[model samples]
Structures are given as structure tokens and as C-alpha cells.
Target: MDLHARLKTYLQNNPEAVGKVVDYNAGTDRLFPLDLTAANTELTTAIIADTQAFSNWVSDKLRANNCRYGIGGYMEHRTIYAVSSHFDTEDEPRRLHLGIDIWSDAGTPVYAPLAGKVHSFQDNNNQGDYGPAIILQHDLNGLALYSLYGHLSRQSLDGLSVGMSVHKNQQIATLGNNQENGQWPPHLHFQLMFDMEGNYGDYPGVCKYSEKEKYRKNIPDPGLLLGF
Candidate 1:
């Protein structure tokens, strides 16, 4: 079977093995679907460029919907990356987001959905970068899998080390503020990868539109494990 097929089958077979990536309660909290694409006319360029304004916009959306979390952006073609040159390239700009972003308040806790060992971690502190990020290595039977948590608080990396074992539902990190989380609104960039391609600490969360098919093979929708 292919990677996507295997992942979907594994998740479907072992629902109890996966845990929440955030402090979400199905009974009390609602998840508001957020749109950061060009279709979202309300997100003006000015608000996209201004960190505080963008944060306030996210908060307003969640509050208006009476939800605790704003979630979306898996394989989403986002225009918000125009706010930073970090995503620009001579060939093409990276506009396709390869992860699911959980928009929430800074300092909100992030948890591991499965037991794994820290594969790599570092603070990618560039503008529009991932900020404090982590990649965990997991095994589904014999299949090698990886999970990345990005836009995390610097404190999240405080005692972490390579190959450190983490348990399911363990509090691994917290969401960071705009001042630290790549100058954007606070959110957790959760992604799953079949391979790291020798990358350590950080990987491209956004890919060039032209290379979407190439990345699609390596990166799959995180919702497979998130159970959204």
C-alpha cells in the first residue's frame, strides 16, 4: 500500500493510540473553521501585514463563533505568506501550506498524539519561519512516520534532546506569541511526514505551488492523526 493509504488505515484501526494535540474538549469547546486564503475577503493586506491586527482578527472570529479554537489550513493555498519574504524564491513563492494550523492563544499547551522519540528540534527564528519547532519519529508497525510541531514557544525547547522519548498525550510544547512565532498570529503548525529527507529541526511547512505533487507524496494531511 502507499503511504497515505497506510497512514489512513493505521489511524482508523488504532483510534485509541492517537491523542489530542491541543487542550480541546469535545463537550465544552467548539472548533471554528478559519479561512486565510485569498477567498477570505475580510483579511485585508494591511491586517495580514500587521501582526497584532491579524491576531485580533483571529480572536474576533473565534469569539464571534463562540469557539475556543480556530482550525484549518491543511494543504491550503494561503496568500498570507506575502507578508514575509521568507517564502519567496527565484523560481516561485511557496504558497501551499502543508500543515494544519490550530489558531489559539499564546501559551496554550500542545500535546503529542502518539508515543514517539524526538527526531530533531531547533528554533527557526526567521521572519515567517516556524519559530521553536520539533519533529518526532514514530513507527506504525514497520512504517516510519514523523510529526512536526511548529510555532512553539521558546520555553518549549528548554530541556529537549535528540531521541528523547515522548508519550501519547504528553504536554510537549506551548503556542508562541507573534513576537516569537514567526511574526504571525499564534497557532500550532502540526504536520505529518513520511520522510525528513535528512532535514533536522525544521522542514518546509509551505511549498511552491509547482511542487505540490512532489511534497504531497512526502507530507500527508495531519487530520489523519488529529481525527478532525
Candidate 2:
């Protein structure tokens, strides 16, 4: 199925996350939009430049202006689901994206949207992968589920263990910079998964467009909660 169809099915099955939520056009109104500027070489160069200077200047600039930096691209930017480099292989195949990303400055605090237990934690520690990451297992309506928070600082996972309890709105992780993070501009890769497939410490946040059906079954749109 296509992204639209898959997303609709997931929401219909998982109403508690999507039901009666505040409305926010999250993909729109972001500080930056990931477009051809991001797809082209010139902008890639500029991004490298910005990444180089990000720690010393960018963070302060966003905070000083009191701007709530966004985590994903704007709706006008035409963000599409493609297999990320993290899982691409000529010997094998590619995997596509399962979640929407919001591009924001680093060091921003990531909050737990609801109370849950720390299901697992890991330092994925590879280029184009989640750096320091954590997943929380939530019991909603007697249904077991999980939320994955990616691109976090190493400090975020310190003292955190599998099965640890986390409170709602609790500060779990501080967003990391590019050096410690997965070498992209700072952003959170938040994903919701119904079945972990017995996986621990890592899960495919991206899947192949061709295999969208299989992945969409396991991963659901995070906006069902955050879009509120």
C-alpha cells in the first residue's frame, strides 16, 4: 500500500493515540524545510558548513530568539518516504522511512508524552542510524505498545536500563549534536511500533517503499499523538 493508505489503516486501528487530539499542521510552519535545497549538493555543502559551526553558534541563536525550532519539514517541501542509507545494500535492498522527522536545533529537551516503562536503550552508534536512543513500552487500554526516541545524547541513556519506569512529561533525553548524533542536522526520529518482533536496542524506523505494507503493520504514524 502507499503511505496514505498505510497511514489511514494504522490510525483506524490505533484510535486511542489519534482520537480527540489537538490539531496542529506539524509538517508546516517549521523553521526549515527539507527540499531540493537539502537534496542538492550546494545545500549539502552548506549543511556541512552549518554542522561544523552548529555547536558553537546555532544552538544559542535559536534559544536567544525564543524560537521553537521544528523537527520535520514543511508540508510545502514535499517530504516523501524513501529508504534511508542506513539500510541500503546492493547485496540486499533498501528500507524506507516509517516516521515523520522534525528538523530542530540540538540540545532541545525531549519529553515523554505519557507515562511508561523504559523498554530498552541502546547507542546505535553508526552513521545514518539513531545515536543514543530509548524506547518506552506503554500500556494503553490494556494494549501493549512502544514509542522510540532517536538521536539523543549519550547522557540520555546513562543510568537507564530496560524495564525502568519513566513518568509522563519527564525529561528523558537531551537532543545530541551532529558529532555525537547520527551526522545529520539535529532532529528527533520519533516512531511508534505495535510489535517489536522481539527486537531490542534497534528497530527499522525506515523501510522500502515497495515493502511499505510489511512495515506499516509494525510501525504507526507518531503524529497520531504529536500532531495534537
Q: What would the per-residue lDDT of candidate 2 be over residues 1-228, giving only the tens digit for each residue?
A: 644455556556765544311123446533433332235343333434455553334445446654455434212222122223566656644435666565565777787766789999899998768888888898765556688888888888889978888776678887887877776567777887877898887787765456777776677667666753
Please give, for residues 112-145, the per-residue lDDT of candidate 1 as tens digits.
9999999999999999999999999999888899
lDDT over C-alpha atoms for residue 7 of model 2: 52
TM-score of 2: 0.71
Error of 2 at 70 (Å): 2.8
* Model 1, residue pairs in steric clash: none
Candidate 1, superposed: residue stretches over 4 Å from native: none
In model 1, the number of clashes is: 0
Give me the displacement of residue 179 in model 1, in angstroms.
0.7
Q: What is the lDDT of candidate 2?
A: 0.64
Clashing pairs in 2: 71-102, 71-103, 72-101, 72-102, 72-103, 95-207, 96-206, 96-207, 96-208
Backbone clash pairs in model 2 (N, Cα, C under 3 Å; residues 3+ apart or in different chains), count? 9
